[model samples]
Target: MMGEFRDFVARGNVLDLAVGVIIGAAFGKIVTSLTEDLIMPVIGFVTGGVNFTNKFVLLGAVPESYTGSQTDYAALKAAGVPMLGYGAFVTAVISFVLMAFVIFQIVRAANKMAPAKPAEAPAPAGPSEVDLLTEIRDALKKA
Candidate 1:
């Protein structure tokens, strides 16, 4: 069982999959930072300085012990307030689209860089079964 496990781990596809998962995690973080820090800020600036992350619909009353501002979405949530965080959902959607676009571009560039496969040569033709049978029939008639 240990030997089989070792063999499975040692397989090239398993190793490649592990590497891909690690790289994908790191790439996701990069995309998240790109979306949250850079793109969202620019978008906010363009839309009259609207912070989408802090936008939410409050469903519950603020707790008596809560000290944070009433308008603070993060604070309200931290204080156990029930709210629909649609802004965060929008941000996540934008991030996903950006990540998909970036990955598509990467794949496109990789495809362009890859060497083209040569066309396969066609197989040589031989006499058909019917032609061979006809020849056999002629020989049998002569004999």
Candidate 2:
């Protein structure tokens, strides 16, 4: 069992998958930062400085123990307020779309860089064994 586990871990596919997962996690953080910090800010600025992060709908009354501002989404949520955080959902969606687009471009570029496989040539035609044997018998009769 130990040998089997070692063999599984040593396989190229498993190693590649591990590397890809690590790189993908790093890439996801980058995409999330790009979406939240850069793109969202620019979009907010374009739309008259509207901050989307605080945009949410209160589903229930805030907890009596909560001391945060009513308009602050993060603080209210942290204080156990029940609300629909649609702005965070939108941000996540944007991040996912950006990550998907970037991955698609990478795959497209990789496809373009890869060499295409050449078509296999057809085998040459030849006489059947029966024809060769018949020819051999005719020659033997003549001899």
Candidate 3:
């Protein structure tokens, strides 16, 4: 069992998969940050500052007794408010679309850069065995 386990862990495919998973997770975080921190802000600014992350409605209002004066989605949620988190959903959808588009572009560029297969020439025709034998017989008769 130990030997089998060691072999499985040391295999090239398994190690490559582990590395891919780690890199994918890190890339996901970077894309998420890029969308949230950079893209969304620019989009919002261009669209009259319509902030996407804060665009949610609360089902329960904070009681007047709650001294904290906060109005963001998290604050509303922390106040036991039922909410529709549409902003986060939209952000996620946009991020996914962007990621897919970037991946497609990368793959397309890679395919374009790959070497093309060489064109093959047609094979030359060869004489039949009978034809060769006839020629040989004629030469032998002449000799």
Candidate 4:
């Protein structure tokens, strides 16, 4: 049973999957950072510094004890106010699209750099063993 377990662990598929999962987690962090730190800020600047993450419409009553800005999404949420988070949804959508595009471009570049499979070996040109044997048999019959 231990040998079986070792064999399973040593299989290429399992190792590949583990490596892929680790890389995927790291890539996800990179995409998230790109979206939140770099892309979103540039997009906000292009749209006149509109902060999408903070944009929300409150549907519930504001708590009387709440001292924070009513328009602030985090504050309102913390105060137990129900709000529609369209801006957050939009931001998530944009991030997803950006990550997808980046991954696609990466895969495209990888494919371009990968070496192609070599062509199949061609058959030999001389007469086959069967043909030679038949010729020898005919010569023997003639002799």
**Per-model C-alpha lDDT, please?**
0.93, 0.93, 0.86, 0.88
Model 4's C-alpha root-mean-square deviation from the true structure amounts to 5.4
Candidate 4, residues 24-112, lDDT tens digits: the string is: 88988888888888888888999999988898887878878899987788778877888898888887888789879988999999999
Give per-candidate clash totals. Answer: 0, 0, 0, 0
Where model 2 places Cα greater than 4 Å from the true spot, the runs are 122-143
Per residue, candidate 2 scores C-alpha lDDT tens digits across 13-77 of 99999999999999999999999999999989999997889989999998888877999999998
Using all chains and alpha carbons, the TM-scores for the candidates as numbered come to 0.83, 0.83, 0.70, 0.71
Error of 2 at 7 (Å): 0.8
Worst 10 residues of 4 by lDDT: 70-79
Candidate 2 vs candidate 4, lDDT winner: 2
If both were scored by TM-score, which would come out higher, candidate 3 or candidate 4? 4
lDDT: worst 10-residue window of model 1: 58-67
lDDT for model 4 comes to: 0.88
lDDT per residue as tens, model 1, 1-143 = 99999999999999999999999999999999999999999999999999999989988877889999988888888889999998899899999999899999999999999999999989889889999999999999999
- By TM-score, the candidates rank as 1, 2, 4, 3
TM-score of 4: 0.71
Model 3 misplaced stretches (Cα beyond 4 Å): 63-65, 113-143
